[model samples]
Target: MDRIDGGGTMSLHFGVFEVYGPQVGGTLSWPHPLSDSIDFADSQHWVDIAQIMDRTGYDFLFFADGFGYPILGDDIALGAVERGINFSGYDPAGLVPILMRETTGLGFVITANTGVDHPVQLARRFSTLDAISNGRFGWNVVTGSSQNAVAELFGHTEMVPHDVRYAIAAEYVELAKKYWEESWSDDALVADPVRGIYADRTGITRVTYDGEHYRSDGYFGAPPTRQRTPVIFQAGTSPAGRAFAATHAECVFVQATVPAHTARNVAHIREVAAEQGREDPRIMSGLTVVVAETSQEAHRLAAEFDAMQTDDVVATLYAGNTGIDLLALDPERTLHQVLEAGGPVGQMGTSNIERFLGSNGAPAPTVREIIDDLKGKGTRGFRIVGDPHKVADGIEALAAETGLDGFLIEPVFGTRDIAAFGELVLPILRERGRLADRVDGETLRERMRR
Candidate 1:
């Protein structure tokens, strides 16, 4: 295939609430005094949401999972639960089959970290899900971020450095691909009635990989799914992460806070992929949408969301993800102080910090600045609050300017927000020829290719 011209337009592939689960609502946590009022423990509601996403022409629903909770400010996670903030939930993968069963045609993407699961076990589990979902499965490869997660589950004191983790991930993926793509030939499965032969023995081969981080022996157990290897999705923007995605990822998730930054990252990935002899990978950025009948209503909704956000909860969540103890800093102190202090707790790396801070400005925004921005306006990745046409226009403008593949649509209110996007913004996108008509029976790869 020829390179995608910088000028050529492409149809956007939409993803629903699949990326972040109900946990997002907890970002501000439940505003209601009663925790019972908002219940995410129930899986049935998510199943119903899955059906809705599939019916609405969403290409896929990607699930983002983390192994540990935010452990900041002496067990502030408790506050997360009390505030009904995004604290408690089952594993995102556990919810995948439930959602898959409710929708046919909607792709299912699950996050599995190399730091947590063994290579053979992880590969087998993904293979099983691929079989169960009839090949509509993708893995968002993640090397976990939380130290609590690593220490609690794996008995490690903390996660390895970012570069080392990616090194491990690179080997893990290479071994997995060998098992998924190279182990079994396209003609591996041949059921012969006369001979009662299920699979041609000659067609299957063993995978023997001895790498620095992982090793696996024997052929892949399950037969190849529709897409032999599930679509590879990755979310790393660091140099090492970009290198890994360039070689293996079919889809790349970016967390830039601005359109220009997102565009730069997308271009970098494409350039790296070209150097790696791979076609351009689809790039999706994390986006939060606030939509209403009018722009004014949208602003009101955003304000309501901000009103719901508590600084304590935001600080806790931030510290949890960044390994920074925000409580140590005076709330009044600017972010520049923290940068100057250069404490190990919050200073993970430049790229990691930038994910929270928009790249357009200097020493990165302070916690106060970030919170204020979220309150007044939204950050990065497309924040448009308007009627259907207005939202569509924002999406188009972002696409045209940044050259993004699509968005991982985050809903303000669990499933309802995504449902609204499908009902309202989708039609306008279709009319503008930015989205493709529903294509029946297409594999995830096929749909994404379109």
Candidate 2:
């Protein structure tokens, strides 16, 4: 927690932000020689990445996932499929145990939707993962995206309002806590073979809940793991989302492109956390670094990656995240005008728009301008294109300015960017004591706190 001016080594935690699908971001460089065409269906791809991250001093791997894809009118968007724009992927939670088995000292956080998954089901699932990982597991709790599409896929007639979904998530998490923390006492599992008793039945309690959005009446199926509840990770920046994260999240994720905006977000979340009688949660922002041996080489590589980005891919991803269907909107209309018209905004829509405005620097921009700007950023967040030294300086300066505890290293072109950071920048960070010393038997929560 020491700062540069404080005359102590700064220790910043780092994690890799990844998607299980082929298109990790908006970039369409899968066909390019530099890009990695990972087989989404293969577990080996994840295993390979996990080992690399584990060896490269990464604290964890965070996966962003959902069940629904972008849509055009009433059908799935063709661009989403053809362009491979964050379209398809398998559930990443299933990869946690696999990755844990494949690596040492590395943690895993997978996305789970509170809207669609039952509290009991989610609680038990995470409990199983927690046991498997020996406490190296975390949960990225989400309300889900593509509101209408997800609702239809889940067989719901109507979509839950943005704020209402958070209200429900609050209750959902409350009930899940009962299953995770209250169902079994700390000494409930007593495997005494000589006494012919596997557990202390009296210590186990049945959980009963009847909330507005969920109801449960049963004993938890899983027992306490190393950490009874997995570390809670949330990325909701809307008013309700921020409140939810302030109350429950142990680590909060943000995507404000500018350092000043990111600083404000961290301060606001800490203020809310203080108001809620909780300690400051660890806040990490999205970051994609394109680095090489020299500054010129890095910029050239970044330009090459940028050239692969297309308007259709950007718009498709924007529509998928915000549910606005940018391709259908008036190209001449400003973002403010589009918001004023009022269309479907998905769970992530509000935060995404806020980041767009912050990055664009006020003065609402036209749809065409938004698309053009998004082609470079596209919700992937702050990017640094330079050599090892510049990348290190930017990271240290950002951490000092924003008071962020961590950075989620998103990929610019598959894991190539990650490898570059590990090889070039990580050494500088380590030399400067910007990263925590690795410890054996450290849980995900413990590692992240460092």
Note the Cα lDDT for every prediction shown.
0.70, 0.82
Task: Point to the candidate with the largest TM-score.
Answer: 2
* RMSD, candidate 1, Å: 3.3
What are the per-residue Cα lDDT tens digits for candidate 2 across 287-351?
A: 88999999999999989988888888887788778876777878897666555776564444787
Q: What's the lDDT of the predicted structure labeled candidate 2?
A: 0.82
Candidate 1 lDDT tens digits, 220-284: 87787888788899987777777788888999987656788778888988998998888788888
Q: Estimate each model's TM-score.
A: 0.89, 0.95
CA shift of 76, model 1, Å: 5.6
The C-alpha local distance difference test score for the whole of candidate 1 amounts to 0.70
Worst 10 residues of 1 by lDDT: 29-38
On lDDT, the leading prediction is 2
